[model samples]
Target: MNERNRTVVTEFLLLGFGKLHNLRILLFIVFLFIHIMALTGNVLVVVLVVFNQSLHSPMYFFLSQLSLSEILFASNIVPNMLWLILVEGGKVSVDLCIRQFYLLAAATITQCLLLAAMSYDRYVAICRPLHYAIIMTFTRQLQIVIFCWLMGFMLSLIVYIFLDELDFCGPNIINHFYCDIAPVLELSCSDTSSVELATFLESFPVVLIPFMLIIGTYISILRTILKIPSTIGRQKAFSTCSSHLTVVCMYYGTLTSIYIFPPSNNSVDANKGLSLLYTLVTPLVNPLIYSLRNHDIRRTIAKFLGTL
Candidate 1:
């Protein structure tokens, strides 16, 4: 890694499913459809939560924030993916790639934090019903949401700052659809051990700690549900959490698979597929999951649709 032999790389060629010669156009169409649907669904949720007084609880507020973060997350990745699809292999400037990486990281980390916060909200509602009102005040919810966003950006900023120290010498090719951290690091000629170590250590608090919080909260919630003498009461309480739990499993399962325990062969294709689940599929389906499972969202959506 001699500086004299190092050549500066100003742009990266994203080899995004370029081998799918027969399916490039088809992939583009499918991804475009997903992008549109996911955007529309998340936007509707945000609008409903903002305008509908009935949907103004801490849970709904967190849902709206999750939707907003998903919107940002998907937007940061999908457009570039679509471009890569059409071009077969798209080139992106280093500066633009760094920006995309930062935004994607921030949005996703924000969503993770929001999900943890949502679980805490549910725990308060189910386990401490009497104190729910006093515990999750409007100001407190706002503060929690703000903290999630701030922590997300600050953590991502630390990683972004590390990228500044690395040098991409040559072979400016990223095997994934977008500029993810691992793929970008692979192309760098610098000693990326520190960067890799930082990311690994960072994932603990960023991913594991929040995930563990959710698990602990849910365990308490489950205990509270079991204490209810009536079967109907238990079912009713479980219903409150089932949707969030479903989303949590789906989001974290794919995320941990790709990042925390990346594939043995370092299969870029496998990572891309998993990435699609959280980025495209989850965002599109999240609204449907919540709207179908929650009576309030369904009723509001039904009434809103009936008028149109």
Candidate 2:
């Protein structure tokens, strides 16, 4: 911690799946396949929402934004990870690591804001069905989307500014597949208590604020569903939410553990696995969940594919 003993770390060695060195080739193949699936599926959704006028509701518009964020988010890490796994030399320059971290943070923050807006949209649609169109008009929807992206940029830029000041000295080996905040901060030669505290406090608002909003909205949504007079109406109401709820739970569940829970002796592996869940598994499943469960999307996809 002394200025005299301070060292400048020019690069970091990402110890990505270090334990699986012997199986690097296999891991590369698996991750590559996941990357392909996630990218293709999410992009397909974006494309459909863009070109297909029938799917251009407020819900689908928000969804396209989410899909685009996922694509950018996953790309920030997966491609680098695959490169590391294939080459088995995961060294990255400090500047490049910071860039990756910035992009990742921006993408995630954008998603959090976007998801909150989406939950509110759903809340209006289900709770105030008669006034849904007027409430969530094109202009309002566009405003929410813009606000989400702007907030994401501003919040993440603040974090990145703090991170940029930290000095990484020796032992520049990040114990994760990607340049995440915790690992990179841990390796900093300078004191990181303030930054760590800031991250912890901000994470609550960044993650749990949206999470709680979703919870409150869904509680009302569920109550409304139960009050529906007919069984088919109940089922229809429930179906509208089932996919988003599933994705929300899965995304928040993993992230909540990462930020809120006490770090443990085995936290590295646990965090790594959790990262895989949100980064890879979530995107991979999103397309399937929406397309399969929603009759309109299913029919649209079917008609689109029939042309191919």
Model 2 TM-score on a 0 to 1 scale: 0.95
Q: Which ten residues in a row have the lowest lDDT in candidate 1?
A: 260-269
Deviation from native of the Cα of residue 207 in model 1, angstroms: 0.8
* Number of residue pairs clashing in candidate 1, backbone atoms closer than 3 angstroms, sequence gap of 3 or more or interchain: 0
Note the residue pairs that clash in candidate 1: none
What does candidate 2's lDDT look like per residue over 1-308, in tens digits?
65476669989998778777899988888888988998998998998899999999999999999999999999888888888777675799888898898888888888888888888988999999999989999999999999888877787877788888888887988888888887888788888887787677777777878878988999999998899999999988888888888778777776676656735847778788878777777778877788887787888888889999
Root-mean-square deviation of candidate 2:
1.8
lDDT of 1 by residue, 10-121 (tens): 9999998977979998899998998899999999999999999999999999999999998999888998889888888889998889889999889988988999999999
TM-score of each: 0.97, 0.95
Candidate lDDT (C-alpha), each: 0.90, 0.84
Tell how far residue 41 is off in model 1, in angstroms.
0.6
Most TM-score-accurate candidate: 1
